[model samples]
Target chain A: MTPQTDRRLQPRRFLLLTLFLAGALLFGLVAGHEWASPARLARAFANSGGHDMTSQLLVVWRLPRVLAAAMVGALLGVGGAIFQGVFRNPLAEPYLLGASGGAAIGATIALLVPLGLPGGPVLAALSFLGAWGATWLVLGAAGLQGRPDTAGLLLAGVAVAAMLGAVRSFLMLALSDDTVNLQVVLSWTLGGVQTPDAGGLAILALLTAGALAVSLPLARGLDLLGLGDDQAFAFGLDPARFERRAVLVGAAVVAAAVAFGGLVAFVGLIAPHIGRWLIGPRHRALLPASALIGAALVAVCDGVARAALPPAEIPLGLVTALIGGPFFLILLMRRLRA
Target chain B: MIAVDCASVSVGRKGTSLLRDISFRLNGAGFVGVLGPNGAGKSTLLRVLAGLRAPDAGEARWNGLATPRWPARKRAAFCGYLPQQFAPAWDYEAGDIIALGAGRASAGDASPGHVLARFGLTALARRRWSMLSGGERARVMLAATLATSPALVLADEPGASLDVRHKLDLLRRLRSASTSSLVVAVMHDLDLALRFCDRILLLEEGALVADCSPDDLLAGDALDRVFGLRLQKVRRHDDHDWVIGLG
Candidate 1:
């Protein structure tokens, strides 16, 4: 008989994760070009409303940026975990599965076309459509019969991402003469927290909240799916319906994240894997844990992106990719070796 | 009670029939063995009967309502389905995987814990999917299937990959399940089927060639005709006999 996985150390791990998230949030709040001293932040926190310049900067600039980063990170993280579960592949994530690719294309189209008639930002709306459309296309193409074959789905995701990348590149080149527009689009393509306006942030928050609410309850269904379609069916869940619902929620969350920043490459992939390592693979604990870790990872990355070169910020996506690309390689090597 | 009323299933570009107008009704708890040659559509019939697939024509019903009409959870609560080959790819703990079968905390006395204990798998709960031996995985799958206390247990070749000891162990579990739940298994072992099954369903080319007790089936020479082999019964004991197949 195989020995049980050790459970005694999980509480300590959870504690460390929580502390890391808090520390990351603090770093995002204080570590900018004009560093807000820990004493100043504490005084501001105690005062709530003050006539100080530091307090106003905290309210007007820092708070929204930090909040936006956390929400977007959580969205990608949770989206990644769900995609991994639905696809039954460790490498599956929102960016790799065509959700963010679709979102990026949609956001770019909105930028180029200038659809002014909208209750919400045209960019956000189009990105949502793009996200849902691309993810669904992958699923439908992989297999519309019931559950998708993992290899086929992964290949389809890669194909969709590649085709969409070509379209995005053409659109970006079209704006080469418009250097300002090109710069903005370029930042987004590389994936980073652009830190939206209040309205944009509100929409992102709403989308993130709604997607997470739906995903947590379906954890058990995801667990069943790891076995395969036939076995999940025998266990009572309509595996097809489960896959569709997972796509619907996952796509929406990914779109909201990508709409703000661009591709935001590795948060989804990195967060869920780390979450699984920290907590076991049961989606119940794993999903929430992934969301927390994702929020922390992006917040810290965004902080570093801003603080790295005081006057000039590094692209957040570039930073994540630097970390994520190697992480992906290690995982691949391990899988091959095994 | 479970009944398949003129259920037909066809597939492929040529519309080849997999199960052809098969009909049968089985009531209460008893072991029913489905026997067939290669390409006889035993697996197809099992899928149709399990309501995992909708038949091209007619219906498979539990009680009076068509099983397809039942919500997936209700179907899961009522039926246990075991495929010929099923092994989870993820590294979920064996206990967590088995708990996936329980629609409620306890289905009569058939909770995940109870089923695991019954299979002497209480110590194996912590084992991950990768860590399990084939025999252990087989037993774990069986435990998960039975955890819901299903009214109907449908097994497709449950004994396909085990050694003699594990095969007998699996057979005994199925036999016990049949005491309270109807067990329908796609079986290849003629000797085991004759010894354990109360009834046998012999299919030839997607047709129900024989539906009878072991004696009636043997006396009628249906096995001889279907398998294209001579069946000779040799005396072993007063209550048991050894059946041999020869050209």
Candidate 2:
């Protein structure tokens, strides 16, 4: 196709994606409110609920939390899509490169140590450092081996994650005999959107936006990479350099999302595959579609988890795994048969 | 001229070398077939020449300048490489796959449609790669590599899965196109290489056993030594020669 034709098609795709995301967001909002209180929800909408505490709660707490869920979910989804596309492996996810394990270990350390520092900010910072550190270590290992073998990198990630998980378990066992502290650690492990303070959320939004901006240009590069390393290099792409940049950008996006919303799984793994099935493997289409679908899935899941039990909410991660695991298995079976 | 000057090039992972003391200068436009047994380092040599892997000992030079030291993108612009068993993970359309070959071309220059048409892939332009048969996919891949219009094309086992007719068509196309470009292929089909290529490089145990024209390289002694083949060349009615294996 001509460049002009590609450009023309972009607007139509953009419009369709926008409409889909808007509809999903609206559904989540209305459903969340209805679930919060079906009777009060009707009355609140009917009477225009003039600047009451209830309205404030909905606007400030509920809205921001839902938006945060969508934003973080989108980042994970898009990051995962890019990862899968570059690696040419459908099973790859944002955490496959050891970011999540590293971040978890970092967060665990922050909790275990009496750092004399503020809790929320310090924990987030440590998590970011850990994620970055793990990625750098993996890259270093790959470089030292002369060739960045994908299988080797994957094995290294699994090894590091196992080591970190053991350390985290040890820390939890040592520090938390009290139920509340234990619950906090457990809840953190079983992911949730933490309803970040406005300042923190704003910073996260900025970082996420910046990462997306940097990554958007790589859509074409990712497409080239999908052709495999030799072909990509033949097409004038410096695979090693491009891979490093992509990994760093992807890790940063994931780290930012994890910092705000702890340890959400499956959205990253599933969204991209679904997007590829729907939109084909064109990164230009797959990236945005995965982002939208991911956001919608998380928003709907979070809403369901929140309202499923009247007073007791399920962890968002558990809900996602419950839904994603069976579906992932089915997809795997189909792929294998094919 | 599409020249490659290699001087004592060696490549390997650790202590053992895959390709050792390889030195050659290819200075003309012609088809050069590299023939070797399974582990004789034919692919490694191609990779080193294509600048995909680093040479441990010596340099691969293009136009008297070292290829590794040259600007990567610039070097890539002049050389196209096709590795063994190249399969796209995602089902990219034939056109999109070919368009990747037009690297660094402004969005305005040579649409993939034009290249696909040239390679008789116009009808299959929108077809997903996964849907195509192995032969068709090979053609599409060849189209992708050719879309670059590089001075040098290094293809490893380019005709592996192609049928008899398509194999001949590809060889003929490569030979006809060699007036302006150098095509280096690692070929398993000795008869096809003997029929199509100008020069043949025979390798055994990571060393060059023979490097000469096809007429000189395919003699009884060289064939027996390099390929362990006891074969007789017989003339066919269509002004072609065929190698018949003798037990």
Q: What share of the true interface contacts does candidate 2 keep?
A: 0.81
* Predicted complexes: DockQ each: 0.67, 0.58
> For residues B1-247, what per-residue lDDT tens digits would candidate 1 score against the true structure?
5543334444222577777777887878989999988888888888887887777776787876788788877778788998898756568878877778764333567666777787788898888877898788888888888887788899998878988788878988999999999999998888888888999999988888898998888788889988889989887776766689998
Candidate closest to the true structure, highest lDDT:
1
Tens-digit lDDT string for candidate 1 (A1-338): 32233566667777888898999999998877777887888887787746798887776678788878888888888989988888887888788778898998888887765556662478777888898899888877776454455567778989988888898899878746775767767778887776678887887788777877888988988888887888888887888888888887778778778876678987999998988877778888788888889999989888888888988888888889888889988886776577
Worst 10 residues of 1 chain B by lDDT: B4-13
Candidate 2 per-residue lDDT, tens place, A1-338, comes to 21222334656755766687766555555555335454554555465653777756665676677787788778888878876765566765656566776677678778777789998788878887777777666666545222344556567766766776687788889887574666666776788876767886787678767767877888878888888777888888887788877877777667776766667777878888777766668887788878887887887788777777756777888888888878767765766677
Query: Residue A333 in candidate 2 has what lDDT?
Result: 73
TM-score for chain A, prediction 1: 0.88
Q: Candidate 1, which segments miss by more than 4 Å at Cα?
A: A1-13, A30-60, A119-121, A144-151, A173-181, A197-203, A336-338, B1-13, B104-111
CA-RMSD of model 1: 3.1
What is residue A153's positional error in candidate 2, in angstroms?
8.5
Docking class of predicted structure 1? medium
lDDT of 2 at B59: 84
